[model samples]
Target: MFDQRKQDSLAAWHKLATQAQQWMDPEQQYDELLKAADEMEEKGLITSSEWRQLVRDAGSVFTGSQEHKTH
Candidate 1:
């Protein structure tokens, strides 16, 4: 029925919104950013120089003197 489909769509949207909210959390944001950086490096999206700069910039945002430790 139309009503049922609408309800299902709403539920799916709500779940996605919740997931988006979780991804917005600070820790999650950091993790996701690191993942993206790693992926970029692996896919050759950024040169080593660019990646180092990105890491330095991102490290500055975090607390502690340790630099961003990439795998």
Candidate 2:
């Protein structure tokens, strides 16, 4: 079991929790997320292909859960 609600890694956990809550919010938009992805890509934190996948993931998140396609 988790020992505390706030931990040494609170920032990371908080980010994940916030995203999870937002994903379930009907009014939630990907504006900020897309912007962050763009910034990351521009800063070379993520490659072009990785950024494309991030965009794809955002689409899947907005359209409901994603189903992996069998090869």
lDDT against the true structure, each candidate: 0.49, 0.51
Model 1: how far residue 25 lies from native, Å = 1.9
Residues 1-71 of candidate 2 have per-residue lDDT tens digits of 23242232333322533465445452244454566567666756667887787667666654553232122
Q: For model 1, state the Cα shift of residue 15 in Å.
A: 22
Which candidate should be chosen as best, given TM-score against the real structure? 2
lDDT of 1 at 31: 52
Give candidate 2 regions above 4 Å deviation. Answer: 1-28, 65-71
Candidate 1 least-lDDT 10 residues: 62-71
The C-alpha RMSD of each candidate to the native structure, in angstroms, is: 13.2, 9.3
TM-score of each: 0.47, 0.54
Off by over 4 Å in 1: 1-23, 63-71
Q: Which model scores highest in lDDT? A: 2
lDDT per residue as tens, model 1, 1-71: 65575455445433433353444644554455455556556766566776676555445433222243332
Which pairs of residues collide in model 1? none
Question: Could you give me the TM-score of model 1 versus the true structure?
Answer: 0.47
